[model samples]
Target: MTRQAISSYKQELLDTARTLRQQIRAGEFTSTTSGLASGLMQGNIVILTADWAQDFLHFCQLNPVSCPLIAMSRPGEPLLPELGKDIDIRSDVPEYNLFVDGELTQTRTDIADLWNDQMVTFVLGCSFSFEEALQRAGLAIRNIDLGRNVSMYDSSLATTPSSRFHGNTVVTMRPFSPADAIRAIQVTTRLPKAHGAPVHIGRPDLIGIDDLATPQYGDSVPVHDDEIPVFWACGVTPQVAIRNAKPPICITHVPGKMLVTDKLNDELAIL
Candidate 1:
């Protein structure tokens, strides 16, 4: 894309994010943010108590590819001014998953009632950001075309541990022709914060994923015969870690329902 075209795309993204966030806050839009607000950064939300924050922070550091920590709020603070001037951790996300004792207990649209001074919010870079980059590069994302959530799998690849946080890496897969996959690698490589590039390509067995049609999380889209299945380390990896940690209370954005941020995707990209 040319410099002028890039600037125009970014402005459109900013406008979309601003409008979408208002709807999200009003409880009017409560679905997947995937393929919406293109060119803006979408984040995976993780909220925990101060007691578990340190260990969780360590978990992010140890598994940077899957859990790249982009912004965090101080203990007891629900506001993350770094991500957006209006971002409120307790209400910005479209949907939230509440976990207790390593098991998912409930899913909520807003966590205002659960917000406490003891709580801390962690925003991790999401693959959705790079999906936009792929689309801009003229690559077709099957999930987007199918109008469903991206396919996610629990891989055999274990992440480095940090205290009680340890689990297999979770990945998001996108099918592409061999030629497009190469272009995808080149495009995504520029965005490290977005889990930059595929970790595994062509073979699902190597990653211990038995079936592409049946994903461990999210809806599955068809992979054409000529296309290769490409996988990238996913932000949901921390949810697995949180489950292993078994903290007293944990909160995260529902998989596919991310927190749309004001930051531009290009801001997280490298030359």
Candidate 2:
């Protein structure tokens, strides 16, 4: 493809996010929206029956680090206009992991078939939003540099339980020199919506991570002896929570794949 053609694909992905709420509302685009829209906000998706929404909401409130709530759809309402002018919770996300009795059975590009009047969609901010800031600052993201996804590990830290939802906080890891690690922390701190600061630096043992080479989710990036491994709270924590919640049924994005949005990453900054 020509550079213009590649740029066109990127533009289509970015432009679609602006009207993603509309496309999703109309059932046009539904696939993992990762790396498509650069500065716009992307999120982890979760959906559960209305009967379970309360408990899930409580779970998020109880464990904000692993479950920061960005926006949630009212029961049966597919539209999340507050998140975007025309977002449809039913089909906006590119892919959805379907869990039956706490076990993921299948994956779909859209969840319109599973839509119900009593279903609620929860959108949680993702760390990918801050990758832009880190890159702009001259720090190389190992996953991005390697054209792969960031590595995620299920930590030993148990999240505070709420009713039926409880599990460990899954974390994403990146390697950098102590100096670059500090810079990454500073850059990511500005985007709390995208996972904020490092929860642990240098010592994986402190967080119950016995092995850094094997991740529970996503591909592992190499860590040079001179570089320290930095860990951040990940949106994938919800998957673990979902498995533990055992909600008759639940849905979420596959690890690494994320829902791209029109909201800018800078828009999430407090400063």
Best by lDDT: 1
Q: Which sections of candidate 2 miss by over 4 Å?
A: 1-34
Q: lDDT by residue for model 2 over 1-271, one digit each (tens)?
A: 9999967765675576767545544557653344556677888988899999988899888877777788998888887767665566666666678999899999876787888888898999898888888888999888887777788998888889988888888999999999999999999887777888988888898889989889988887899989999999999998887887788889898888776676777778768
Candidate 1: worst-modelled 10 consecutive residues by lDDT: 9-18
Clash count, one per candidate: 1, 4
CA lDDT scores, all candidates in order:
0.91, 0.82
Q: What's each prediction's TM-score?
A: 0.96, 0.88
The collision pairs in model 2 are: 21-86, 21-87, 30-94, 31-94
Can you write out model 1's per-residue Cα lDDT over 1-271, one digit (the tens) per residue?
A: 9999978877787778878988888899899889998878999989999988998899899889999889988889988788887888787899899999989999988899998889988999999999988998888888998899989999999999997999999999999999999999999989989999789998999999999999999999888899999999999999898888899899999999999998988889998
Candidate 2 has its poorest 10 consecutive residues by lDDT at 25-34
* lDDT of model 1 at position 52: 89
